[model samples]
Target chain A: MNPEMLTKWLIRWGGTAAMIAVLTAGAGDGVAQESVAVRAALVTGTLPLDDPNAAAWNNAAPAVFPMSPQVHWPERIQQVTVQDLTVRALHDGTQIAVLLEYADPTEDPDDAAAIEFMVGDKKAHFAHGQPMLLVEGGPVNIWYWKSKDNKGVDLWAKGFGTLRPHEHQDVKAKGEYANGKWRVVFSRSLATDHPDEDAQITPGQFINIAFAVWDGRKDDAGQVIEKGSQKAVSSWWYFRAEPPPDYSGYVYAGVAAVLALGFQFVLIRKLKEGQSA
Target chain B: MGRALIRPIVIMGAMYAFLKFVLPNIPGSAEIPASLIILYLLLTLSGIIIFETLSAESKDAFWGPMQRFLTGENIGGLQPLRYGILVLFPVLVGWQTYNATAPSDSPPAENRVIHPAPPGEYTGLANPVPKTPENIMQGKGFYAAFCSPCHGANFDGKGPAARGYNPPPANFADPTTIAMLQESYLFWRIKKGGVGLPIEGMPWKSAMPRWELELPDEWIWKIIMGEYDGAHQTPRTWE
Candidate 1:
């Protein structure tokens, strides 16, 4: 075909392909960000607390986040047993539950998992909160679950060495270990009475959250190999109790589309006038 | 309506896809930031447009189809296509605008000096440790013990502790990073780490620990040599 005919033919099909590509470009997971938000899907019924394999969990999407060794402090662990964490969350308007799952080769007594949320409006460094001397944000509220205790503890931390239990222990958790994997579930009320100590989970807002896991590998004498800061950790990710459907985004986009069409029409008219002149 | 008009747009799109998607996934490639991508595309578009429109015949070949399409001229069966483009163009623009204006939970992009100037005393300083094979081997061991936790054993910066930190660890394997820097600058950065950066390295976001207190000066020099060797790059010369 001649170049003119080829151009016309190409334009006919290529234009359609390009349009489709442009429309779907947003869907591509191009590059991995440092951390992506873990959404807490809204559900109509009660959350499946203490149940990792509950039917209700199927409604929520799981986000697998990479975990790294804790190398910030002097007692840091260079190697990490847990390389990634599978997290799922659900909220039933009043209560929120999070399910944490990871692979563990051994079931020593020291196996534990914890999730931390930024307490108040300020933002702290992801590696536990900022140091107490360099505290630029509010404290971090941690919900810790241990395999031995088979329960969760509500704790608060200002920095690395300042972890302490909250006055009101409102968080609850349960763990199940089988076939070299540990599935743990932590649940708490969306809003707590203690505003100063606990992180309030409000709908339609994003909050910073982090995770840590201890594999509980023990020495020959039965001493825990992973202790204190020697564990796998994740940086601050986002947690949001998804709000009700908002149509304002669509409305704005529709208006903008109409305006853009009008601009194109105006541009074509001007071009025609210039051609005639 | 010849290939002249459509070629530039197609090239731009292909370049964009390559830079935004294909390049980052390559084993040793570094990601080009969004701002840099836009600048590059703009330059490429201008260059192609200049070349295509330089001659009268080529100019007509390039602009004829576009003008005809706009005026609904010789295009017979493509009338529906013109309308299709009219509708799709607005939607694409609107979608892009919406994304740009949307409020996000992710932190705002930060600007920091990738390689700030070293202190006066440190600028002229030299690596005391020789770059012998044995020294390089020792440096490799030191790097594995200290740097590999965050910088990665492969020097790709995907170390076990690298994921969580924003302004993630530097991939020394990328030519744009270690290969472009002076040995003395690397020495200064190693000794001081993140806390030692000047004001331009704002937010002090680097998680690099100061090795001055822990490792001796010779060890730091050795680590630098090992880093260059492992990344298969050479330090920039003073000349």
Candidate 2:
């Protein structure tokens, strides 16, 4: 082969290589942004499926629901038990915080059966270990007392991010007891998953919340009678977030494209080498 | 040089063919790869130039293949240009389809309206209808305060907590579902909660309290028939 033919061949190869590099970089950038959006939606968005009220009541009621005293708890008994009811959800978009206050609904409320909203699978304190900062898409559980532990109160709740939370603000939770009845302010904002179900706690969606108290009808031992019964409360709240479009599934599609491009680049280089060989 | 190029190209091409045909490909994945698409565009333009230049040498046959330089026009078929188009079409289709459909999956909207109870013919057990409006009103009030959150106001089974429920609540208004349950079923369900029951989310795990103290036995019947299960008897803060 002459030097002239070799030179022409080398120029064509260099031009193709440069064009391939430019296309790779351009396509790679567009796809990376797309991938982030996809992952966020998959993890965070998919959880809050329906209106918290309907979703909680229709699906979660059997575990924790409200019924006339005429009906008893365990309409559908399962192996798992939910107790010590306390739940919360902060709707940042609306700037409302919601808390589910579980109490005996027998006209007279239960004073002794203090509601404990704890975190972890089994704890009696605050839900999610007294979260220092509210995690947007975190879930928390609760346990309650029915008549000084005559029977126990148990429940589970999952909190999701409806509005992007303000990480800067110190999460200030409060409790109040101004009225004749014991009214503990679980939160300041109606921001739970099922705020509507809570006659008192609104702007939140409801989950596994069991309310129990001394029925007041006691036995001869001077002790509170009956297993402090528990019931589920079905409720909902309205929450909105910025249109999911701004960020979208940019990261996810981006990653897919990136990996695809990287794979293509490597495969093509190998292919070209193999052809030349 | 011919042996060097042909040996590896023929082997790799055969492997590509085999993998493409034999593998259980992921849906939408085995298309014109991006690498192949760019290569196709380049090759097509290059082919036009290469063919035009090669054919110009044999002015009588300007449309013939470039291989005419090494093999007569009757010898080698036009294989290079043919391969380029096959690889290009799929890349275009895939990129376009992904863009068109990705945004369609949006987060669901929130619903706040309460649903009502489902009324249907009882096949199992029947409760005698209450005699007066007072009874109906009592039933309404009882359900409004208690049952409404889960069963919904209209009893169509679209309560607030409906989504997380597996085997979502039976749409009470639907005759198909209502016909399945007897008055006794509602009574039994009302009397005993369904924590561990076969009912959807009520999975034998969580059951509501026995409200025998809050309400009288008869009011249970009223709430069942009156079906104000989805109304807010008390003011909800988040409404």
- Across residues A112-166, which tens digit of lDDT does each residue of candidate 2 receive? 3323222323211112122111122233333333332222223344321221222
Off by over 4 Å in 1: A1-35, A132-138, A193-196, A250-277, B1-138, B152-154, B158-168, B192-207, B229-232, B237-239
User: Which residue pairs of candidate 1 clash?
Assistant: none
lDDT values for all models: 0.83, 0.38
Report chain B TM per candidate.
Answer: 0.56, 0.37
Q: Candidate 1 docking: what grade?
A: incorrect
Instruction: Please state the Cα-based DockQ of model 2 relative to the true two-chain complex.
Output: 0.03
Tell me the tens digit of each residue's lDDT in model 1 across A113-144.
Answer: 99999888766555556442222456789999
Residue A112, candidate 1: alpha-carbon lDDT = 98
Off by over 4 Å in 2: A1-259, B1-172, B182-191, B203-239
